[model samples]
Target chain A: MSIDDKNVILEIDGLQTYFYSSEGVAKAVDGASFSLSKGKVLGVVGESGCGKSVTAQSVMRLVPSPPGKIVGGRIMFDGKDLTKLSMAEMRHVRGDRISMIFQEPMTSLNPVFTIGDQLSEMFMLHRGMSRKDALDASVEMLARVQIPAPRARAREYPHQLSGGMRQRAMIAMALSCEPEILIADEPTTALDVTVQAQILDLIIKLKEDFGTAVEMITHDLGVIAETADSVVVMYAGRVVEQADTVELFENTLHPYTRGLLDSTPILGRRTAGKFEKLNEIKGMVPSLYSLPKGCKFQERCPKAMPICSEREPQLTEINDSHAVRCWLHIPH
Target chain B: MGPRERPQFTTMASYILRRVLQGLLVLLAVSFVCFCLFRYTGDPVLMLAGKYATQEEREMVRHAYGLDQPTHIQYIKFLGGALKGEFGKSYVSQVDALDTILERFPATFELALVAILISFAVGVGMGIVVSIWPKGCVSRILMSGSLLGISIPTFLTGILLVMLCSVYLEILPAFGRGDTVQLGPWRTGLLTLDGLKHIILPALTLSSYQLAVMMRLTRAGMREVMGEEYIKTAWAKGLSPAKVILKHALRNVLIPVVTIAGLSFGELIAFSIVTETIFQWPGMGNLLLTSIFETDQPIIVTYIMLTSCIILFINILVDLLYAVLNPKIRYN
Candidate 1:
């Protein structure tokens, strides 16, 4: 999609995050590029080990060093390249201009601290609010996330709250500063199905209320359908396809994206009064340490051409609002 | 999310009561072992009356000390006296054995406290430093130096310190507790300059091994905690690295480290025998050694019982600390 430059709050161009271990250097995110517009939800869909989470971590500058490093990337935000910002400068941007929530709410909150103490820490650190004022703000923020009896819940520890409640508390803490961009990295993946829907709704509602852009990373396309306006499909650390959610689903171009859609179980779709066998893409993901020179998806693509084994396909635009990476889509 | 009904107070109280009861049972078992040592180790009457005493006089001494009574009767009398805080007389000095040990306890307690405080401060500080900059030269040196601390024997460490600080340098005293200040019933070497100088060597000696252990534990714990989801959340919240390490990672690291520290403190108190002998410090270890050499059964029994008591008490303290450090640990 042609995103208006002024409306794009965060733009990631050619991001490369690699993990160096005793075995070898694993390119976790190679050439990932996407832009998040203001007050809109952008879904990042991929299977496990597809670099979706790493891309998010890179944006937050939270990648663990030594083993993991963002070797290349230009994360342009607010007229500055975030990747080049010093740690001190980045600290100001994080949680103030951009905030992130994680998948495992159960473990994402500090266990030793009370919910209020942890949430108030955000205000204390960035806003320089007094402890008492920060705590009051924490209670208000908790209430905004629809946590019942926010005042009492604030005094409780992470262990005392249910999974859903803890996720809400996490959301409350992330949104407390009213950040311009919110990154939810599979925010509801670890919760119950019912709670997942609630958390997603809460995020969407809060995003609208605060006019904050959101980058929602998850493997579940259903979540994208429910909350995302646009979707980015990633495979083997590369963005293979990008388009508006409805347009991409209606006219999916990438073979890998087609496989993902076919694999998902649909409601009320039966054959001979029995559920049909679900489709699954063939072959495991290529080892990141020793990826083949051709398309990363060549081994698994049902429609792979001989050229797919010779040259890696670059992301190519098929139309004004749709892009795909495949030999079929590219004029070669 | 409504007010979580916390019955924590009652559970906590009952938990403490149960632990106390268990402690009493352990003490009872220890007392039985001590009583066995008193009965079977040697004839106290023979030692007290000496080779020069007449047979009739020896019999008279045995009768006076309840040694002539049957084992069960003697045990009952011993148990009764123990309940009233009496532990018979020391064969060497003819003073109350319990009183003698209690008098020496202050010296050992003071030494142990100083040793643990020093070890904890320096060890944990080093651990934080190394964890933050695992590859820095300073961190590498500290880590390697900690290896030496762990490898060296306590007595050897004591002797080395004595040779360096006492024999070679001659700036600090190497032996004895020096001039002590009496505070109520407790005698301490902490308030006076001479006393402080005198304690430096022995305390350093006593702390070396514990310091190494604490350093390693904190380093590993901090490293592991830095990888936790919560720590990443802390960073994403726009917190400085210092704040994230100190507030988020350190608290979690302390959970396991505190348990070890508590146990290590007890160990320092019980096993400072070699250091005490090397430095001629007037601590319980010295008293216990002297009693063992002189075959002062009463003092030996009392010492063993007291050491067991301290260990058990520390265990309870560690358990309580776990509740403090991690809210997931309910007292119940």
Candidate 2:
């Protein structure tokens, strides 16, 4: 599906990554396709292991091997195919052209070094600045991310700071270079709700201030609602639906997307309950390896049809910047 | 701490003082055990003179060394004298124990310092490289080699080095702590200085075991840290692998790595016992071993105290480092 003709900074076509494990070949990103434009937060939402994070990692070429391998894909960044870059070339592109903030805050910053050292080191190595220049830039970056007492905190090691502070430091490091694209892979998963909101806001402001495009990978539909301009709903290693955020919420055609939205615990919306519990999809996500022949997610699709079980439903455009891959949504 | 609080300088000084005091108590307890254990083994004169000492002469020697005093009085006197820079006299050397130890200390220091430096630079560097550069033939070979190094005994490894390097290379010394061809008091014990005139073989003998251990522990620590989310995040941010491994991975890996490195230093002291005996190096290890053989109770006791004191000092330093490396750690 063509996602509105904008300045597509990143476009992935039929990206497939498989893992060779004892169990079987796990297709982590099986023929996943999408495009992300500049200054946009394209939220790719999915459950854990549904290939949302893998999609992001693959774009950055961060997927671990043996069990995970990018067997097929074209990651078009600017004019170059990122997948074809040499190891040395990829290293330069990784933090300079593209930056990724990870899920766990505590695990995303080195515990031994002071926050300042990490941030400054980035400047020193990438920007090739003097130590003093690196330090000044680091302090500025820290302040930009709204860290308390940037100078003092810079000298403080990771363990000395609280969880939220570490996440901010991570963002500061990621944004320090002002890469064109910032890939945040569930960056707030480990944070408390309040801190989560603050971090999200910080990211939005940073992106706006720096004019950086964002490919935000997350499992939370609520977070997507607040931040994403567009949303790609992934199921069983494939994009089930893609649309403008408002359109996706207003007219979600895919059964899986419907289930996810329906399941969100909404307060004051249910008749008898204090909070309306989300309706869980009937069955679990299928194993990536040894999946069903045609539709990997057909087993749990509410509107599953015989055609869906035998032939995978391709994502067909239903409206401007909107698409759905479901037999029910298929036009006769 | 308020501005009115103890000046920062005073606080640091007080902290150091407390640490020293703690070291003293530990030294006392350790010295008592060494005194009791060494004395209980057998009389000093019989071991020293080897059935050559007349009864009166043996008594005279014992009296001179203060061995005739009660155990408690000897301990108090020994502890007091040790605190005041007096390590008592070595009956065999017929010189101040401090002087005799000082004479050998340089050689041992040189051997250990070189070995450890080699271990740290090679082991830690290789570990970080292997972790970041995994999935290659060289990385695999390095990792497996590290595992093998850690599993094998240092002496056996030392022997292997001697066989291959000494017997094969025919350049480095295969065995011997150092040669007796001394240049001056400074070069008395070490191979490089006193015997570099004959140094290579013995230095190799001293360092061989450490190479394996250092490589192995560093690999293990770096590998584990590389797996951490922070390291992955650093890599994703487009930081070069070197920066990621050294700054992000190495820093976090170090507490454990340093622990391993420091513990190896302690192990070096013990391992030197065998290496020193094998090579006949005139270091603390050989001296201690010979004193034990001669049943030189006072000197042996003194030797044990010295080793324990070194260990105690190392432990304190490690604790201080913990505070610096990890802010979560509180000395209070």
Most accurate candidate by TM-score: 1
Scored against the true structure, residue B277 in model 2 reaches a CA lDDT of 65
- Residue B153: error of model 1 in Å? 1.6
Give all candidates' CA lDDT scores: 0.91, 0.77
- Between which residue pairs do clashes occur in model 1? none
Tell me, by lDDT, which candidate is best: 1
Q: Write the per-residue lDDT of candidate 1 for residues B90-176, one digit (tens) a residue.
A: 988989998999999988998999999999989999999998889999999999999999999998899888888888988989899
The count of backbone overlaps in candidate 2 is: 11
True contacts kept of each: 0.95, 0.87
Best prediction by DockQ? 1
Give per-residue lDDT, candidate 2, residue B91: 59
Error of model 2, residue A44, in angstroms: 1.3
- The C-alpha TM-scores of every prediction are 0.97, 0.86
List, residue by residue over A218-239, the lDDT tens digit for candidate 1: 9999999999999999988999
Interface root-mean-square deviation, candidate 2: 2.1
| Candidate 2, chain A: TM-score against the reference | 0.96
